[model samples]
Target: MVSRTTEARTPPPPSLWHHRAFRLFWAADSVSQFGTYIGNTILPLVAATTLAATPFEMGLLSAAETAGYLLIGLPAGVWVSRVRQRRLMRHANTVRALLLCTVPVAWWYGLLTAPQMIVVALLCSVCAVLFDVAYQSHLPVLVGRDQLLEGNARLQSSQSLAQITGPGAGGTLVQLAGPAYPVLGTALGYLTAALLLRRIRDPDPPAPADSPRVPLLTEIREGLRYTARTRTLRAITACTATANFFNGVLSAVQVLFLTSTLALTDAAVGAVLGVLGMGGLVGAVCAHRVVRRLGQARAVWLVPLATFPSLLLVPLAGRGVLLAPALAGLFITGFGTVVYNVAQVSYRQVICPEAMLARVNATVRFLGFGALTLGALLGGGLGELVGIRPTLWIAAAGTSLAALWVVGSPLRGMRDFGCRAGGADRPWS
Candidate 1:
């Protein structure tokens, strides 16, 4: 493990806002996040309200959108390793914008079929996976190692704030302008993001010709091997994958629990989910401070373990104003999730070697979020066989178990794992 020594005498780096390249990167990502949210909000509306899509069709649309992660995740990482990241991101954004534009155009001509929508969603998700992987991998390059925590926190905070506003704004736009038209705004958002992204002039290192030309499969295997060999990375990956698996299960049923069991009005349900986004924003705002105080390693294990128990309250949510307990539960869960993500992601970025960062991130994404896809299928199947509420109870138990993966690992006792993810100076303080 590599450990970084802090020169306490050295002052902190300049603010990211003052860094023109970072500012553009931030703006581009902010715009793209909002656009993605708008697409998420409005496309479902188009499917349900305009096309009168069946449940199966809707499910297919979602699957098509997410399939890219399952299909191209590792390859995208390999691609990132072999090319200029910003260039990849720029093209990804432009392609997504064009793909989104096609949806409205097809709809306008009355030619948008369920299959067409599915295809567009699949292609757009492909771009999304590529762009997202490149975006994370590019950050450490742009900001340098020492500033990773602040950079990630700021970026995450931006995403959380976008999550808070984007869906509602998109919904409102759809109501005002029709679902097909609202998607035009999403296209525009991505286009704007592409333009902003193009303005960044980071001195990105070109892929070295002298580097061994490893086979793609070999590259993928090496990333997996490296992550598995790193004790903390492996543990963190297990914890995150566990959480994602259950979260996927919860996500598949959260709406049903809110609507059918709790009998919440649509507006009430929106408000509750909104609270989760708000909590995420709060958590992002506080992450760096919490990490500084708790030390990054302790923050990772403790944050999730501390707050995840609240998930049980979700399955017990009551109807109407009696929903406070569930709301509180979700809020705490959201807060802990954001805090955990900020710390662990920063740790991964700082610890992984630059040559391996994209591949490592890709491998991690595959392991971590791949569970989400499986859990979605599991949740759906279980919901069909058992019922919604029972399925939720099972999922809650699963989420509760995620912390066990980390608690037994190196993170459980670390106090100050300095540079290189080396051992902390003392046990958990």
Candidate 2:
């Protein structure tokens, strides 16, 4: 039998997009993604502006949405292992679509209340968590190992394109048709996603009957242990988690900083953010080339370093030419984030075992998303105490620190995802 290292070195099969099933899935995901972006922009504005929610109340809404990631991530992973991934994704999107519709319905009936909106947000968030975990787990099987990075780049590019138009369109729709109606659009998007998911052919074979079924706790521990044992995975996880923590903090304060500190209108803020989407699109398109030239290890290091230039503009918030600097900074930040994500995700997908994909994904997300929640809390409280500019400065400092996670790790030297010497047969080929 061929050694794992030899197998790893061999090229994987051709791309999955040539298959009709994957093409449909891709189309559906692209269309629905636009809708998700619309909802993302409209939801918080509805809570704060329409409901007259306090900062603390708004923070609670954010927390409620993210908290599900912490609560259900591990369990969802374990549960996903026993079911068909495509079916679970279809159901998840369906439920999300249905639940999102309730927001507009509540408003139509004059029954919209803060507590009810919070509940809707929480439920919708839970569905999002489920769909994301299932979707990520399914990708490796759908596309072979060699094309994983390209596949992800295509997905990210779609999302970035959606972001370019989604927010401004969402804002206009909300202004014209009201906040509740935008959610209807989001609901329809989910329906489209579900329809697309249905057309994708299942790629993973059925689990072995003789495969051991471990205890839930043991299964979770095994997933974590596997991640810990892998040098590349450990570095990727650390880098992603740290980056997310700081990025979350910045996200929490961005709108407030733009509007209050920089003296920009809401429209201006939205326009600037919409423009930043282009940077993400550029990064996604260039990621493959960057990885090819720099190698995976160097790409990870380089992406985060791109973010540092943006942080320098934080202190220039109130200067005469502030708008130009701020817009430029956000664009660069968006670019860095997408590049970093592509490197980290592609590496994770290649190294992880097929069986543990969902569990490992859930575990990583649980920790990273939990950090996001904490970061938001920290940003909000710090912003209140020291003002938005200072809060932003601190958040930037934290984000800069994320680069350290991989600087000295073994991941810094990794050239690719091939198996180690003397290991089992390479799975990618």
Candidate 3:
């Protein structure tokens, strides 16, 4: 492993709020995030309600949402690296908006089916993969590396806010207009985001003309190799992948648990899910303060370690007094997840060479989200065989174990990233 001990004491740049391109990027992303959360709630509800999908079918639908990350994540990174990221992201948003439009149209014509919804979800996942890779790769260039934590936290806060309002809005729309029409707002979110992206005045830095082009497989291998060799990165990857796999299991059955098991109405379900976003918003707002108090390395592992235990309360949820535990559990999960993400993602962006950032990120997502795909299938099967409650317990336990990957790794010995043996520690790079 190549471990650097240098302190980053570089002077801070102007605040990102003053940067025009970044402001546009942030605004566009905020609009897109609102739509994404709405789709996240309504799509599965469509399968469960209108189509009467089985638990296993729900698994298939959920897996389809992330299948593109497993299938095209690595290759998408290479493509993202070669393109103008702003334009690429715009195209991805447009495609997602168009694909989502098909769902409501099919419903209007009374042609909507579980199969069609799954197909649309799968196609949107492909666009999501492209957009995510481009966005992550483009952030450093847009705001400079020093501002990653601030930028990510802001973006995460927006997403958290959407989570609160989006699900509530979706459930209300479903009650008023049926499940189909609520998707109109979801599609409009993406379309509006794409339009807003056109106003960005700054351009990506031009790639070096003299740089030799490598074969696709060669580039993929290079990225994989780098992630494998970095012990810290490898540990983080393992932690995130394990958590996502189990999270997939939870996602597969969570709605079923709420609606079928608890007998909650669609609007009530949306409100419960919205609570998850509320926790995330608090976490995002507090992430910087936590990092300053706990150090980045500690924040990454310790927060999850402290908070994940709440997940055990989810399976215990019942109709009356028991629901409070589940709410607490979901809130804590969201808070810990966002805090851990802000810390680790910024850490990786700081350490990885800029040339390899996209590839390394792709590799991480391929492994992490690929596991999520498999876990969703497993969760559905388990829910059918054993039951929803048992499956949830299993998922909660498995997710908690994920913190061990980082706790036992080299991160335990360091106070802050690159500060174990260095002089005055760097401000976030």
Candidate 4:
């Protein structure tokens, strides 16, 4: 028999981004994200300008776009577990490309009705959810466990870059060629993504034939159970869900508030959004160092503290000269959001078991996206009743309370995932 020392040898060198498979996947995702940013701007413009949709109709359109996250999130998680994740992603990407292509065709035929747009949006949303879940699950397989944070940071940075450039280009394209033309860009992006994904050799270990297969409900419950039982994850989820809720409210009212109340032009609104992306770029670049210096627990609390005060700028925007302060506030809010997101996502990816990743991610997304839907509904109704400014004030107040969920919980003092095993033995169990 081999000696104990010999049996305890080091593992192989980790794969680098230069690895051909990883390069292909990264390139695909980078281009796909840029396209998504372009599509985001054009889609709403299509609904509002081309179709002449009302505020309620626009809210419904937004709601319909996110509805897939709530409806298919869990079921998609289950379905993904039974298939090869890479193959699933390829199919999903193909479907998304086809669906996006239809929009331009319908526009050419003058058959792009509001109802048809809603249907296309819903279908595209569902496909996106599938692609996202599969794509995230595929990461651990490609990059290995140790490089997860760095890999995620790279992806986030690329996405932020896309946000900064895509909107300006999309807006220009819309002005020149019409709203439908920009969607062709999105379709081509998806097609390129699919081709690149096809080149990624599956690096994941084969699934064990005898691995236990749990019921769908039981699998979901298991995921939730694990997350609820883990202190860091629980706090992060609560904080993120709450943030999404309040932000959703703000999103629903922001354009309306700008256009109707402050009487700002669409061009001005686009400029502000682009500035917000600049702030996000700063946050994303600095997130890793910030987490290392501040520690993860402190970083979690810092997010809201940095962000919530900015909401005051919203009401202040109605005052003539204060509009600059409001824009600054929005920038700060975007910065804090990016910082919080990087930490939270990295932490979750590190702590969770490999097998449960898809389910846990889906469950968290379901809660967060559901909150977004509710917030949009509430914001629309409340804005109609109390007026936009007061509605924004309420959103600010609600957002401030989100930090409370973390303060009293186990997340308050925890420093890292290294302490998790000991903390898992607490009374919260």
Candidate 5:
């Protein structure tokens, strides 16, 4: 009954489900994440249970998994910009799958060793560095900037879901069969993800033929300066880096604490971790609502402040009823951390220049993950010297303090972030 002009006004926004390319990307990313989570759980269990590794070896193994992020992160960003993101991601996954395949193969032949596992982890880390940079950079091209929040939210929710199911499945498999089966499953997952990625019909456009070439170091330095000059990015990076450092410490000792201190079985450990990961699922689902209620800027700093202090309970966990404290602490920490990640990642993506996005992301990750590697080593050494509980206490207390970086920074005063390329702080809407 209405006129055409009147009816056409203010049409509804397009849904991501209707976007075929995004659907493909989501499927690939989800599959890859699910496998990665399984690997994360099973690899550590292999080192601890199958190999009977010491505390320092556990820490060393943990550090190896993330070492590539610190070692090759910066250069990977520049490389990602030069290639077709989809192809790169596919290749990276394929390489990772092959590397992971070696683990179970060696184990079957009765040739598996701790050093070989560490080597596989290290090589996979390099591939992960490349794949991650390509993945994050490819999103804007696959879906428009307007759909970023929804796209990111959906992706994060899937990742959280994987965090819950992956560990449980891996642990259950390890208990029922052995570590080799889960390791094989992880390899298959990566191969499947690679195949899915190859099916993306709409791939990233080729670079311009006339685009000016620059030296690699020059490009790297430019990204560094850009991030350093941006007040919001700098503050966010500092907080994230600090948190990762302590998180590394926590991760290095978490399994040890659960298996040794509490004397939980492998299956029980996975179940506990899976239960704790439910918090991330809840947080990812509620992230948009939280941002709407609290404003994005407030959500970033305020959520961490509210939830991170709960980690103090982790060191207090023991047998029987005492385990409740650790469970509560991990759940609360996961919730806050996921919410903060969704908000901050969307903000950075919105504001960064399209050409510079990969570099900026890499720069942030380099610092954050570098700290993680150091923290892992520290956690291992401290667990041996002082004790597991004391290390946990130190890690928890340090993580709680990380929020202070943003609390006093310029971001505290802003409601949301502006979309300008260089450090401009204004309300987005």
Candidate 6:
């Protein structure tokens, strides 16, 4: 058996930015995030503009990106658990970089198709899931459990900044070139990230043995069982799942609400939507402080409740200046979500055993992200059945009630889980 000390060969850093391994990860992550944001925006734009896809095709594109989360979430955890996290991350980025490069090449040949974009989205989302689970697991190795909150907060801020900057950059690229052209930037970003990741020199755990021929389903079940039985994991997963469901409902309708309901020009709508990114930046900035002031455990539940009511503004949203109400609600939601995510995610990282960290993250992503997929379908279906405004009201109502999932759990009453809070009980079965 590998000794514990050998597994964690590098000591935790005092400050992430100054630490060599952490800095490389951070730079790589920032570039990847910017690229992801660009793809997130530009992908749909390409479908609408270059492909001139109908509503059905556009919705299919949306589903393609999230499809991997529902399809490969569990198996990904199992796979990541058996591999070295850093190596997996590097390999995944490399594959994604190569895959994205194909998009522009196809476009350059005047052969890019909607179906091709869908395939690209599907493959990219799968690689993203693989990298993400490993990426979260690797952070605790580099930064230590105590610093997880700070680490996540800094990372969130960078991501929020990317969200703010990426759309504008992608739009600029599309305007200067064409919609398919922005994909080249995403390819370059992934390549840069792979190079940055290669610079890290942390001690890698040994590779998984081919002789250990365990059934894949049995391995996947291990993570599912652990998540199903852990109280905190189950609660947080449920809360996120429910929240994403309602958020999905809004996502399907929000675009129509802005253009049709609010009558805002596309330019004005983009400006208003930028408020959402600013809100996320503010939340990322305030996440650690909010946790400090509210106590980590209580902050998780409190922030959600505080922000839940604000979502009603979306239903009440009107035309022109009246859009302020919905924008304010988005700002509040952004702030509350970042604060809650930082506290809860740090808690998850600290309390999980090092060996199971990747599994736990993957399991949580499976449940929480699966909710988003179902929610989008629900939103589109419901919007068609009733009206968009009624759908918005229903979605907001559902969101207001999602906080109940965490409130009844152990997470509500505690201050912190501590470094070793449930260390002995890492596996539930």
TM match of model 1 to true structure: 0.89
Tens-place lDDT digits, model 2, residues 19-117: 666677677778767876777667766665577665555556656566668778777777777677778877888898888888898899888877777
Mind giving the per-residue lDDT tens digits that candidate 6 earns over 75-149? 888788778878888888888888888888888889989899889888888888998888888888877777888
Provide the RMSD of all predictions against the true structure, rounded to 1 decimal.
4.9, 4.9, 5.2, 4.6, 3.6, 6.2
lDDT of 3 by residue, 298-404 (tens): 88889989987789989989998889999999899889988999898888788888889889888888888888988998999999999999999999999989999
Worst 10 residues of 6 by lDDT: 418-427
Residue 81, candidate 6: Cα error in Å is 1.6
Stretches > 4 Å off in candidate 5: 1-12, 419-429
* Candidate 4 least-lDDT 10 residues: 418-427
lDDT of 1: 0.79
Off by over 4 Å in 4: 1-19, 202-207, 262-267, 318-322, 420-427
What digit string (tens of lDDT, one per residue) describes model 1 on residues 1-429? Answer: 999997678788988878889999999999998887667656655665567665445545655556677888888789998998888888998899888888878877879877888788888988988898999999998988888888999988888777667756765676667657778888888889888887877776668889989999999988888888888888899999998888777765565566567765444444566677677899999999998999888998989899888888877877766688887887888789899999999988978889999998998887776777667667756766788889889988899889988888877667645743335322131
Q: How high a TM-score does candidate 2 get?
A: 0.89
Angstrom error of the Cα, residue 46, model 5: value is 1.1
* Deviating ranges (above 4 Å) for candidate 3: 1-12, 421-429
Error of 4 at 184 (Å): 1.0
Question: Which residue pairs collide, candidate 4?
Answer: none
Over the stretch 123-232, how does candidate 5's per-residue lDDT look in tens digits? Answer: 89889889888888889888888878888888888888888888888788888988788888888899999888888888467665688988999999988888888777
What would the TM-score be for candidate 4 when compared with the true structure?
0.89
Q: Using alpha carbons, what is the TM-score of model 6? A: 0.88
